[model samples]
Target: MQYELAPMEGITGYIYRNAYVKYFGGMDRYYTPFIASTGLNHKELNDVLPEHNAAFMLGEEENAGSGETPPPRLVPQILTNRAEDFLAIADRLRQMGYSHVNLNLGCPSGTVASRGRGAGFLGVPRQLDAFLEEIYKKCPLSVSVKTRIGVADMEDWEELLGIYGKYPVEEVIIHPRIQRDFYKQPIRWEGVELALQQWERTGSGIPICYNGEIHSLAEYQALRQRFPQIRRVMLGRGVLKNPFLVKQLGQWENRLQATGDAGDENVREPETNEDNRGKQSSEYCGIGGYRESEAGTAREQRRKVLWAFHQELLDGYRKIMSGDQNALFKMKELWAYFGESFPGKEKALKKIRKAVSMAQYEAAVREVFYSKS
Candidate 1:
């Protein structure tokens, strides 16, 4: 029942990670938003500063020594096509005391794909294989790769996994969909199932972490029941939409009973539940046992998580905006992914999107959250 936080560019960062850990609390590996490795030099230091906008916020402890504890297992993910560039940033991260790095091959953003950096690289397996060989040869830390099933079609995955199985990567996080589908289709579970069977048969030893379209505890439990071999899962938009999903997945039946006595005698716990017992929220920092009830209780918990996230965003935004009023634009991007968490958030986000200054933006957020309907 191990869980890893999925990286969403311009969305999940240190601020989000800090708030998530403080509240909902069920992430084992926290991945930073992907860092682009196109430009390489000390001149670009501020662009990836651990204290600034970068996803890893270790600089605060590295320099300020605030005695504040670090978040759970923060790992920086890098996006690049050049082998040398990947090695260079890997060296930089090692210098920053990071032990493991994740390569991004799952990003479907048109810009990244157009550059043959993300899913696009899957179409060129030999090139990607060469790139990894060079990277692993010089890399100073352990490496993992987050990738989709294929670039444009299901047929592309066989070659992609073939390339992956040949490497000694720490783990292969797979989202069961082709790149062009872009989340519009149901997850290609069959594709993932095939990969799992092959991995087991080959005894690759590389762990396979499932990802994509997992929205609830039931869904996760069902998957585990069907494939008892899969051990790890990565939560993406599901965690954003329902912060308690991973926590609930481990004790879904008990939660169902706690929420409001379930009467269905047929609702029984699967055999896989015991295997996933360690994944309970209780295991993560001892925070567990939230019963899912009517939507009211759910909304309250959502509000609490959102409040913590909002406060962290405000703090991070202020630091980024200081001496640089232009830095405020970044806040708009933050709202694009997180605003949906707030009640009536769509309207608020729309208003904030058009705001020209901090004052206007504040008014917009207030109107959506504080104004009487």
Candidate 2:
């Protein structure tokens, strides 16, 4: 199973990606947050800069002489309704050594959708077909599309799939939610099933990856049980909520392989022992089995690791942003997702939110980590 980190606009930038690799590394690929090519904004260019995307080397042998490693397999993503602009930015990325690019058609933000980009582009199938036609004819890099099932109604998916099949896209990532749903309604897995049915029935040969609401090993296992054909998945918020999810999933897979599970058809059911595999605490199990007390110790170790990762983020932002206020703003944006991991952190998080200066922010963060409560 291939795991690609979903491109989250504000949260999955290079800085976050680097820090993630340094601490909890398991993602096979990391998609850059969508870079909207609106006349080449400085911030957008900086986001995809090769220098900023280099991978971090952890151990002495891994570091060797250079101390830095090659970046993860990164596919820069772009959000545009115009084929010309898409091709233009893709060509620029290819020149920068990227071999692939992903198109953002799944973003449900009102600002982007209202402008007839992202999911709103699905409303005009004719224009979208033309856009795909032009890009495939002249594109320099492999183009994959990340798209919602529809714009307003589920019926829109059939036409969208047909259009996607008509092109030679490397892969189609289906989020299985309409624009109107906007991450609120249950993921219409039926829509995803329909896509798989269409592809199998037509033999489109275009690979498909599932996305949306997959946050844990059990969720991923359930998805595979439902659709054994799915070989790739993209995770965004789930990984943000639990940075160890990908690593834990990988360990689970290795355990399955060691148990002689031949293929997707013979994948083992998740352990039924509630005591052994409680969803909330299963992440503490590494390669070998861990006792309940060991799990508690592991949780403490994870907290310390998270603290180090947090400091790396703060230092990274400080170097880039001019003012301490600007840096704090970035950290606050991260906590919106990161805070979900700490179940009873409301009080500490509130203090962090109300912090007005660097000193106040540091003190609050320290209290959050050190507090007995």
Measured by TM-score, the strongest candidate is 2
Question: What's the lDDT for all of these models?
Answer: 0.68, 0.78
> Measured by TM-score, how close is model 1 to the native structure?
0.74
Residue-level lDDT for 277 in candidate 2? 35
Stretch of 10 with least lDDT, candidate 1:
281-290
Candidate 2 per-residue lDDT over residues 1-373, each given as its tens digit: 8888999887788889989989987876788889886555787788877787767221123434786644457788999999889988987887676788899998898999989999999988898999999999999788999999888898878989999999998899999999999987898988988999899888999989899888766688788789988988899887776676777677767867787563432222222223333344333222112222444666578777888999999999999899999999999988776765554445777888999999999988887666643
- For 12-104, candidate 1 gives per-residue lDDT tens digits of 765566667777676777887887854544423443456543334432235346676445567778889999888888788777667888999
- Number of the predicted model whose lDDT against the real structure is largest: 2
For model 2, name the residue pairs that clash.
none
**What lDDT does candidate 2 reach at residue 24?**
86
- TM for candidate 2 is 0.86
- Per-structure clash totals for the candidates: 0, 0
